[model samples]
Target: GAGVSQSPRYKVAKRGQDVALRCDPISGHVSLFWYQQALGQGPEFLTYFQNEAQLDKSGLPSDRFFAERPEGSVSTLKIQRTQQEDSAVYLCASSGGHHSNQPQHFGDGTRLSIL
Candidate 1:
């Protein structure tokens, strides 16, 4: 199968607007993770899912951010009422399936800019 495919590549949004970012992990991958990465910083975990079950979301910055993996294949990260602080590269990573502790494959990510 192909490697992880992170989508949109870029986005520009005004403060207080909403945005949705999509990610496609490797085919048949059993786990997905979403993160926010600021310039010069490592990716910050926002949420995670195993199949269609959201197993952890404690890292999400605020209530305005949401993530889902419905049907267990594709994942989406949504931000409501975007803020200037939300400007960053949103990343998706996946690892697992009959295995654990495998290295996660990262995507190119969507660069989000909030004006």
Candidate 2:
């Protein structure tokens, strides 16, 4: 079975530019998550989805961040007006169940750099 997959692998954006990152979770997995990992910092949860429903987005830093999973399989994270502070690796993970203890599978992530 395939693990989570993210596109672009790397991106460079000038300050104030908008960037969209994409993720494809493993087939049939019901729990999906998005995270941001700044340099030297552990990944921080950005948003979560159960199937096609976005259940939690409180971790998003500000209104500039948005995420969606329209069909419960493919998801997207859009960052508007990118800033240098937004430079980091965006990670995507998926799990088989919604339970708190369910182990998650992670993707390599798309690294974004804002100049």
Candidate 3:
């Protein structure tokens, strides 16, 4: 089974460093989302996109975080001037679509460590 793929299973960066995370969703999936999960906590939504359109981003903590799906397939999440509080697992998920009832498939996620 071809599931979502995420790059850099782990990342270590110093405070104020910038990092970019990559996500490759299942082929043909139309809905994509980014989430952040802290220790002993459930994932919290950070952003959502339907195809090439980014429909929601209110969950982003600050202007330093940015996400995009330029081609409607591969997506990237970038964080600038990373802070210690930004340390967490960044997850990427994809589903069939808004009109479809397919459950979301998630990647292994990238654990970011801010020093």
Candidate 4:
């Protein structure tokens, strides 16, 4: 019954620093995805995992961004050496499948602010 959740809801960091955001998806859901939403822009796919196996990560902008799901349940997104352009909302969603129209439930997201 637990829905997707992201921590901090907001994060502020100086350029060249690092930050980590957490996501907890609904219990029993096997599909999880991460997306980045810039101001006024649609959510862009960042990465996805199905039961601890990372199915895709082509959307990750740079090597500075990393994500992992060790136990097939919780996930973490870590951004290293943050830059001003990295400021955006980090969203997490979960669904019953890997399709684009699976009616994913979303967490509010952690809004990262790079200064």
Each candidate structure's TM-score, on Cα atoms with residue i matched to residue i, is 0.96, 0.95, 0.96, 0.94
Tens digit per residue, CA lDDT, model 3, 1-115 = 3999999899999999999999999998999999999999999999999999999999999999999999999999999999999999999999985685579999999999999
Query: In model 1, which residue pairs have backbone atoms overlapping below 3 Å?
Result: none
Which stretches of model 3 miss by more than 4 angstroms?
98-101
lDDT of 4 by residue, 1-115 (tens): 5789899899999999999999999988889999999999999999999989999999999999999999999999999999999999999999875555577899999999999
Candidate 2, 1-115: lDDT as tens digits: 4889999899999999999999999888899999999999999999999999999999999999999999888999999999999999999999997677578899999999999
Candidate 4 clashes between residue pairs 3 or more apart in a chain or in different chains: none
Leading candidate by lDDT: 3
Error of 4 at 52 (Å): 0.5
What's the true lDDT of residue 91 in model 3? 98
TM-score of 4: 0.94
Q: Model 2, which residues run further than 4 Å from truth? A: none
Q: What local distance difference test score does each model get?
A: 0.92, 0.94, 0.95, 0.93
